[model samples]
Target chain A: MTEEAPAPEPRPAPGLPPGPFAGPAPAAAPRQHLIVVRVRLPAHLRTLVQLEKETERGPGHGTASGPGHGTGSEVTLELDSPGTQSSLLDALETRYPVLIGTIRDPRTRVRRPFIRFFACEEDLSHEPPDSDLPAPVLAGTEPFVILGAMAGG
Target chain B: MSTIRVLVGTRKGAFILNADASRKSWEVNGPFFGGWEIYHVNASPVDPSRLYASQSNGWFGQLVQRSDDGGTTWQPVGNQFPYAGVPGTHQWYDGTPHPWEFARVWHLEPSLSDPDTVYAGVEDAALFRSSDAGTTWEEVSGLRRHDSGSSWQPGAGGMCLHTIVLDPVDPERIYTAISAAGVFRSDDAGTTWKPVNRGLSSESIPAPEAEVGHCVHRIAMHPSRPDVLFMQKHWDVMRTDDCGESWREVSGDLPSDFGFTIDVHAHEPETIYVVPIKSDSEHYPPDGRLRVYRSRTGGDEWEALSDGLPQRDCYVNVLRDAMAVDSLDPCGIYFGTTGGQVYASANAGDSWAPIVRDLPAVLSVEVQTLP
Candidate 1:
């Protein structure tokens, strides 16, 4: 959970450093901790997002023994800074704008009735929006899962 | 070769039925955008290949879909319809002031000369237009911000602007109708409007001869004779020859005057069609028979065309926008029913046959004549 500043550019040798005209130290570009997280979307959301699957596997088709118990065609998403559920959703919607109101209400920001959120084999549905994601999910060892609940027979 | 396309909007999705000028056998295409309510689907008059659909659901809100190659493919368009300035209040169902809220689009009207320009009539009673081919929408605030708007009230179906009619002769004139609010006409291209319910009398309203609050269900006008309008009210069929300045009851001799849909023949300006329901409370036809009455002499006399329609134990309601007419030589007449049946008459109501029997209850039907 510690922030990692980006490595500073190698300083030019004494004579190579562009003399007195060198510009003010470029404000160490705000260290944006980019994290790549795997996302497992439900069947309905996968269709709504309309992302072409890289593999032939369908929803819940992957290994179920890992920290992320269920599997599907996983999409890798890149996020910056603290990767909370809210931030992750913001990033997902930014990439797939058509899903603005599909998984969450546009006005209320509440999850849809038949949708569930999970990670590390635990239901993160009720977790606070700003809470940090699970360690396994943050480390890319597990996927942030979006599952459609089994409602009717 | 000339072709005819019938766009049907149902409770679940939209279906496009295409056939040649012969109007004999149709090739059914789809239940496109399945599982979503498609309220209206209309083709652009200038560009037959351009189409627009109003897709919505209770859970996810409203969405506008546009197709460049007719209905072959579609992509979501803008759904943000913010009212201009402060959205004031209108009368709610109980006669109390209620804040204006954005509801689903009830009708989509593409421009006559420009495919990119379109208009939308939405619930909570507002009109919006998009000049960028449905990519963005801005409300034509003049209609909703009129002086009499505060007195506007919701009908049983909610205060929805459901009908839009543009004059073919004069591009400056526009007409729109709202349930429980009667009819309104704009002379300066929707920039301003005035109530045109002068002669409309409804017993359900507080005043029978009031300027507004008549609960108009639908209105139709043949492009050739734009001034002459046909209206189907909650209990009466009306005719207005003076650009809706005044109207006269033409509910003549029919099984019942209570009905929803009304449309004019494509070639014949005087010829009109209406499906009379039993009563306001009972939406089905009388004696459990389905009939579509045609009046060739404009309104006084009528004939029930039931040759190919059901006669016994068939009780189904036809919504206000479920009827349309194609502009072919023979001129086909079409309408869909609550029982999920779409019937078409090639020879103008002389006889009819079902196109597709099982669809979610049809909400609207529109036709395009293509060459």
Candidate 2:
């Protein structure tokens, strides 16, 4: 029985993509365009984000010049044209690196607990992660915010 | 009497829900007790007018509030717990602040012997007794002794004392259930504790024993017989006739023994209600079905109520403490789920009607007929 059989490992086609051995090409760059980002922080995190001061202190804090708190907490992002979801989240994270891991994954893009996103004044809580946010929210000109989700009980 | 009030505890605060008989129109007065995470919201059983709300502020400590006018106003009950004032705090309960200031309370039971005698279980896996109402409190020193430092544990949420059963005839013969830790008894009012977990299921890694860490989610007693218990354990629903000395699995016919709350008839000892959700690994309604089952012969047979339950794919998981049966003659059964829907069964569990929906995920459901 020992001398009867020695199986050979299967081989892939020469050039027609090495089948199982071939690596999937990196995901194509997400379709991009222009949009706005908004975050709604609970009271404690709003203070953590200096949202009150950002609102009261005016656009001076909007520029990325210093790091005193939320002073450097702006998000830069890419979008799928004006008034879209992907674009809004992209702009928010690009401007705020600290928010990268705090909200969506730096790699996976999943929303984190205590962190929430809203668009067009409607709570888009259970929407598909990659779905377009909303037409009104991605105007790129309106004031958008990023904030934490506060849950209890 | 003119309004039905529903108390909601949120991450930031609590909300007071006011509704009329229809239970349809709702007015939400929310974000109450700002910045304090309300864990348990309860109304005095004898007088629905008086309200009790417990809050946990993590590092800051735990706080409780009392309302005299149906949650229209509030006052804080924080300084009652003195353990937070000490230095060497013995064994840390739930691996957290031993007698945490902000330690959450899972059960707020008012003594049947005296309305003022309140039993509260906190994060430290300890039970507290307030003899003279909420004015002052003393730790159940006796039960704490039996905690068995190494074996005691908390649930996924945390180490918690979530269930407190106060005997109407004799408050001294009280029972308390802690998550991760099994059920404990204090026949002499929290002075001494012992293992009342006989017959209960605890299939944790290694093996099961009388020590602790059995993972009992909730336990209920026949309103008249304090010794008789129905518990929604980690894996099964069980019963103990001789006051936790011996047990039997009542959920044998159930597709899954996993559930959060179990309600016994306020008067009839044989009738009980159990809402069986799948176990933690397959956490969903049983068989992916939206059913609230009732066992008329003490869990021997079950009948699912779907008269008003949604036919849609409704798989809302309910918290253990969120479902209850009131003491009304036929008994009033009410339950709330994580998906923000509340159901009421006017005539026991024969049929159920959805009264409130589209609200915030409900944490607790406490109901009392009009005074």
Best by lDDT: 1
- Indicate the residue-level lDDT of B294 in model 1: 97
Task: Give me the runs in candidate 1 sitting further than 4 Å from their true place.
Answer: A1-32, A37-45, A52-59, A62-75, A101-153
State the lDDT of candidate 2 residue by residue for A26-85, as single tens digits. Answer: 244244543334333334434323444355534313432222223333433344443334
What's the TM for model 2? 0.66
Local accuracy of candidate 1 as per-residue lDDT tens digits, B1-371: 88999999988789999889888899888988786788899989999999999987654557888999989999888877787888889998888899888778999999998999999999889999999999989999899988988899988778899999988899989999998898999999999999999888889887899987889999999998888999999999999999999899998998899999999999999999999999999989999999999999888789999989999999999999999999997989999998889999999999999989998889999999998
RMSD of each: 11.7, 15.4
Candidate 1 docking category? incorrect
**Candidate 2 structure quality by residue, lDDT tens digits, B287-322:** 667677778777757777767776568788777777
TM, every model: 0.85, 0.66
**Interface Cα root-mean-square deviation for all models:** 16.8, 23.9
What residue runs in model 2 are displaced by over 4 Å at the alpha carbon?
A: A1-153, B1-31, B34-36, B57-61, B84-102
Ten contiguous residues with the weakest lDDT in model 2 chain B: B82-91
